[model samples]
Target chain A: MPLLKTENVTHFFGGLKAVSDFNLRIEPGELVGLIGPNGAGKTTVFNLVTGAYRATEGRIIFDDQDIVGLPPHQINKMGISRTFQTIRLWNEMTVLDNIKVAQHGHIQYDLKDIFLQLPRYRNQEQAIEAQAMKMLKLFNLADHAQQPARNLPYGQQRRVEIVRALAANPKLLLLDEPAAGMNPQEIEELMVFIQRIRSELGVTIWLIEHQMRLVMNICERITVLDFGETIAEGGPDDIQRNTKVIEAYLGVEDEEIS
Target chain B: MAGRSGNLFSSIFRPVGRIVSPVWTALRRQLAQTPVLAFQLGVLVAVLLEQWQGEAFADLLGFRRIPRFFGIVDIFEPFSDLDFSGILAPFFPSPNNISASPLQDSVQALGELATTFVKAFFYQGPRAPGFFDVTFRVLIYDIVVFVVPILIIAFLLRPLVSELLRRFPKWSLILVHLIILAAIVLLWGDDGGTRELVLIFMGINIILTVSLNLVNGYMGEFSVGHAAFMAVGAYVSSVMTMWAFVDDRVFGAPALDPSWGLPVGFAIALFAGGIAAAIAALLVAFPSFRTRGDYLAIVTLAVNFIVQSAINNMEGIGGARGLNGVPLWSDLSWVLLTTILSVFIIHSLVNSTFGKGIIAIREDEIASELMGVNTKRIKLVTFLVSSFFAGVAGGLFAHVLAYINPGNFGILKSTEVLVMVYLGGMGSISGSIIAAIIFTLLLEALRPLAILKWVVIPLILIVLMLFRPQGLFGFREIELNWGWQKAKEKPEVSGATAED
Candidate 1:
């Protein structure tokens, strides 16, 4: 069984259909990519999966349980975490705190321990800090851990966002646009980092990237979305050669396409 | 027309401002640099003046009594028999009382002191009339009180007081508690009513400000009707005490002995008041789950109106005439203890993971929720706790004033609390405490201003908002010498950069 399976998921914003019959299957330990044009509703699909937007229709099964109408937090607890298209770091909070907050769902201590500031609370907090520091160290961002996330360089902020998602211990990690504002050198580093995340952290990766270099280089399989519909699903080579995906990105061959 | 007036104002005062500006800047810098010293000097002056010539001043201010340097006792009997016709005569006790009254043993005098303390202080104790019969020894003790502290603080302890806040926050908190204790001791004399009242009010204000800070500052919710909760607390606790504990015209007879009300009955009443306020807060908390920001603020305002009107319409209590004949249990010590406990509770809460979740919600509710924070529950709990403390403050306030009415907890009161929160800085506990203290004193200081007080206060707030919009601290805390923060600073790990 797939780690995540969305069977005919549909969402509507008022009368407009944002995502229509969006079926997706992400198997265990697979690096999948969701590719689409600007208005293709790629993010809407991610929102549906993460329960930010509940499906207007159909079932979203994660780990064999249907999580269609659950709140975002509950879905996050079920081990599905995603980064935003634009950065959404708690900007005033320290970088370490941003990562620690993401692990809020799986924290071992209960509300009682937290309020009373029991030894367990402090211990758990220390353990979390140590763990977050470890993740930061792994990403070479340990020196900036005490700094507010917004103070970090853009490339580092994007990386910190990814580290924050990873801190949640997700089985399936969604990257909206990890390579959004990077030069070629940074993009090259990000590509290697993505590979390392898969090989070392062993998270099932699913990403939506406008940068074709990141998409074609790392993603084992690519799914294309166009105008709220899946136009193509294939490996990177097949996707590169697919005329439909090209026309969606580069615009229509004919005026009749409209 | 507005632009012309503005130009005329600047044109008239610009040169005047230039001369005054330098002096004002220097004074501000000095005050800012040595706040502790200034505060100490201010307290010393007030204590000394109240001891020395407090009665004359109190009479002018229309106060029945002025608190003495020693709170309970009016005068020591040491040198009452010695009449000084020359130097130190005014400072020493007059010999006129020596022929009228026989000198008693010092131990017997102390016995009288203990008895009077218990009788007068343990809730509704008889307060003595005003008179100062100063003694030579009393003069020496007063000098020691002034000089020892100045010498210690200015030389040996000034740096320590400032340094203690950062190095030992809990110790600093204890130091503050000790200051309150010392203040109580210094103002323990028979005629020291005005200053003690001011001190108690400051304590109550601190509670009110800190509690509101939880919701308005830390939680980032604009709750304009906080005083409504306080009203509920005030009324409920007042009703509880007046009905069951005290014999009053309204309640007629005590349900239990008046003595029981002092300890057990009064505490339960205060707790009940807090609980009742928390329940009342549901009107806002439930709405808060659905609405936020200005919408939630409107709901709070409505709740405030609802509570005030509800109290106003209740003929059974006292309606708008107000509930009087309340047992005055909130003395300096009581207020001090409760304020510390309230501050400690809030400090612990904000430092918790749950609190971080609350702050995260403040930062970005959507992101916080998506990050697995139960934003709804957090919002609910934050409202309840915030309102609960407001209610507790109301209980204390009602007891202190020995009266309560809907008018006391009106929009004006809520605005007072908001001014405090903003002046201190949002999300700053220390800021609230400092602001509350300053505001309470400012209110008392401006009493002579009458109607001008309200105008001046708003002007101060407007200036504060203009100059420091984020407030003095702005989501940060003062490194106070006090607090019960057990957690030390984050550990420094020396290591190389992460491997590529």
Candidate 2:
């Protein structure tokens, strides 16, 4: 069975239909990509799936539960975690705290336990801290563990955001334009990083990217969205040759200026 | 003479300090780790010393005399007929007795001087509240009622709070709170009434600043109308006290006996007022879902206006004229107790992992939600907690003033709280306290300035905005006796876990 399956998911922002009848499926440990132009409802699809914006219609079955109307945090707790299109790290928090806070769903202690500093609170906090540290070590970002997330370079901030999302132990990871504004070198590093996370952590990956090089090189299967509709879906090689995908990215010939 | 004395003290204390340094450090660490334990051990030593040597001996050590709070001169009273010159003749380096070699004389003199220094730990005399005032029974009352429980709670919260600036003041803060409490008791017990009133206002403002700081500071939300919640707390508590406990003109007669009302009614009423304000906070909390910055701020302002007008329309609770006969039960101790409790709760709340979620919400609401932070629930809880304390502050203000009006809880009151929050700087507990204190004093000093104080306050805000928009202690805390806690803590390094 697919780890994530969305059937006819639809969303509207007032009169503007942001995502129209969106449907996608990702098997366990598979690397999937969603690509679109600027106004193509790419991020909107991620929002609907992550419950940032609930779908107006259709079912999002994740781990077999219909999660269409659930809150973002609840959806996140049910093992769907996403990084923002913009790197939104808590600027003031330490890199370690940034990762540790993502485990908010996993924290087992109540307020009383935290207030009293009970044994349970102590044990869980240590475990969470250890997990965060391990993730940092895995990414070779351990040296900057105590540094504020804002102080890191933009490329590292993106990496930390991914590390933070992974800290939540999500079954399926959502990356929204993770290579946005990244230099070619950083984009190359991110492609390697993305594939590594998929292979090692065994989490299914779905990402939206404007960078065609990174997308074509890494994504096994690609889905293209344009104006809230899926224009194309297939292997990366097929998507690269699809005339409609090319037309969507470059825009249509205008007979006259509106 | 001053220069010579300073030189003499430095010269005399250098080696003596070296000899006792180890003991001092060990004792200080003990004080930090287990204050209650040290407190008990101190009592044991005091009782043993009192038995070993007479009252005069303990008097020189400064416990039984000097800065006495209760006004009872103990048997070890320092000003009694004890001749200090007779006891110190041997230690005095008499010029006529300049004998033998200079080195031997110097060593002997040093030893005698150290012996004399050990004889007097604290200066002996009647003076203002300072060291040794922590030895009084009223201090014990202060400790048992306020400081100790807080210390015990601090002990319980040490691990989480052990990080950051909170770790620095561990032992010294006990003394800091002690001095405040003892000073409050000292001032309250005395007939000098103006100082007492200032202390009470200071305590109330501290609560106002710290509580609002939760929303405005740590959470980075613009809460323009905190005083509405304060007003809710005041009116709810006032009505509870007036209608049920005290015989007021509005309520006619007391429903409960007036004697027990002062004690029992105030606690219950303050709590109820806090709850009412928290419920009232929901008015703004809902708007918070879709509004922020200037928009969310307007919602807070609207809540302020609504609460004031709502209170204004209540005819039985003295409508436009104001609440009268609120029993005047909020004294120095009540204000102090409530302030400490408020500070403690906010400190713990901010220090906890749950509190981190609040900070996370402040940093990025969307990001926090995506990371599994329940933004809606956290926002609701934040509003509830922040307003609840504002309510409590209002309750105290009402009782202390013995009257409150809708006008009292207006936009002007909210401005005053905002000034303190910003003046103290945002997100710093110690900053809020210092700002509250300084702000209270400034308000009183500018009482003669009348409406012009508003102009001056705005000037200060403008000056602050141009320079330090974060306020005096924004995002940073003042560590009490930081020099005393120079020992750095080793961060626990967990070995890397094998991936599943």
How many backbone clashes does every candidate have? 21, 1
lDDT for position B225 in model 2:
91
lDDT of 2 by residue, B1-500 (tens): 12345778867887787878888888567456643323432333333333344245335544443222222223123223223333334445478964446556556666755554433334533542222443353354434434554445545544443443355555565565456455535434433365568778899999999989998888888989999999989998988888887766888898888787867778999999999999988877885657556777878888888888988899988998998788878887788778887888888778666678888998998889889998878778877888999999999999989978899989998998998998998888999999999888776654534455567668977998898888888888885433234332223345544221
Q: What is the alpha-carbon lDDT for the whole of candidate 2?
A: 0.77
Give the runs in model 2 whose Cα sits over 4 Å from its true position: A11-21, A108-126, A226-228, A237-258, B1-192, B447-455, B480-500
Per-residue lDDT over B212-299 for candidate 1, one digit per residue giving the tens place of the 0 to 100 score = 9998888888889889999999999999999998889998998888888877888899899999999988866774668678988888
Off by over 4 Å in 1: A108-115, A252-258, B1-154, B157-192, B480-487, B498-500
The model with the greatest TM-score is 1
Per-residue CA lDDT of model 2 for A1-258, tens digit only, reads 989999998888999988888888889988899998788899889888988788898899999899988888988998999898888999998888898889998877876786566889867877887888888988877777878899998988999999999999999999999998888888888888998998889999999988888888899999999999999999999998899987886666553211
Cα lDDT of all candidates, in order?
Answer: 0.78, 0.77
Best-fitting candidate, scored by DockQ? 1
Q: What value does DockQ give for candidate 1?
A: 0.35
Chain B TM-scores of the candidates: 0.69, 0.63
Evaluated at residue A16, the lDDT of candidate 2 is 92
